[model samples]
Target: MPPTLQSLDHLVLTVSDVDATLAFYRDVLGMVPQSFTPTGGTARWALTFGCQKINLHRAGHEFEPKAKMPRAGSADLCFLSDTPLDAWQATLAVHGVLVEEGPIRRTGAQGPILSIYLRDPDGNLIEISNQI
Candidate 1:
């Protein structure tokens, strides 16, 4: 059998502008932010929610050799939120982030989820969902 996996720890996102990405996630979506310089490398920022986090690496300066084909707008990710879908949309509006699409039905890892889709500054698709 393949090795069993636990929860996700972190994911790396190559971004065109780290500051913009950080602001969108931290201010618009409410992720906790942390900045660090590992060992003796360039600085990086991470936006965390729940127990998982996304590390921002500038497009040209990733830590070591990274993803086989990493690009600024390459990821499409989904997240679970306890807030109602309508409230989530309102929050996005307050932050001036446009809704790409949703509040639609979707399936999640746990079960049925009500999801709202939005795009990050890098154009990465983000789905914010709640259990239904």
Candidate 2:
């Protein structure tokens, strides 16, 4: 029998500008930013949302033994939002983040969802959605 995984823990991403990435995720997206020192005694930054987190590595400074071909703009991620889709659109508007595509009906793993898409500074596609 195969071992069953529990829930997603965290994921890593490479970014050209750590400051911009942190600001976008912290101020615009409302994720909490945190810093820590890894085993090598170097402080690193990450954003946390509930039980999950996203660790960011500066482009050209990724940790060793990572993905064979890690690169910025290669990540496309979705986040579940409890807020109404319209409210999300408004919040995004406040941040001057244009909706690349959005308010479109889509099927989530749980069922139907209303989703909107945006791109981060590194051009990573981010999908935010709410279940109906």
Candidate 3:
């Protein structure tokens, strides 16, 4: 039988500047930034939120076994937030993040969701949504 997917564990993001990307996710999106080293390996960075995480690889210095076309500013990711849309607007305002589009109705994986779209430091599209 073919395998079925259950849930997402993590994903990788290619970034231009690690510090800027880390700062945006950490300060603007409330994700926890972490740094760790593999056994006999170099340091790596990740951003954690809830049960998921995003591993970071520098654009010109990606680790081994990476994407065939690893490029910065190439990802579009959506995140589900329990926080209200109004609150999210305020938070974005406080952070000076420009809204590319949204606080509009959209279809989500489970159901309808209200979403707001913006760009991260690496110009990756970021969508923050709340189930309605």
Candidate 4:
């Protein structure tokens, strides 16, 4: 028998304001709201960009609040695209999203890769990378 493997399901983030976070994800990154739920004093929102899903949960519930701003950039939720690197860079720039660094050419084990990085409204790092 072979082990089964599947695609990434979703990512959840603890946010300060659900509405503001939704707006940022929807308006800025072009994610669409999938659904929302409110129970007791807590709320959760599900958003989708293509097949990727991200859920936002309000901070300060059972979970500890996220660390103060200027957080250490230890994590990232990257987005991958089949689009050419130059076209993706131009599209991102047209939307006023700043690219922190490269589309620099680098060699991957397979061949070559091009990548760029940015941050979301909540300061989470985002990477857009593709193999060339």
Which candidate's TM-score is highest?
Answer: 3
Candidate 2 local lDDT, 1-132, one digit each (tens): 999998889999899999999999998889999998889768999999999999988888987667888899999998999988788889899999999997899999889989999999999999999998
Residue-by-residue lDDT tens digits, candidate 3, 1-132: 999999999999999999999999999999999998978889999999999999999998998889999999999998999999889889999999999898899999999999999999888999999999
lDDT of 4 by residue, 20-87 (tens): 77886787567897765545444557889887787665665423344353232234766666777678
Model 3 Cα shift for residue 21 (angstroms) = 0.6
User: 1 or 4: which has the higher TM-score?
Assistant: 1
lDDT of each: 0.89, 0.91, 0.94, 0.69
State in Å the error of residue 91, model 4: 3.3
TM-score attained by model 4: 0.68
What are the models' TM-scores? Answer: 0.93, 0.95, 0.96, 0.68
Model 2 compared with the native: what TM-score? Answer: 0.95
Index of the highest-lDDT prediction: 3
**Residue pairs of candidate 1 with colliding backbone atoms:** none
Task: Give the runs in model 3 whose Cα sits over 4 Å from its true position.
Answer: none
List the candidates ranked by TM-score, beginning with the highest.
3, 2, 1, 4
Q: Give the deviation of candidate 2 from the true structure as CA RMSD.
A: 1.0
RMSD of each: 1.3, 1.0, 0.9, 4.6
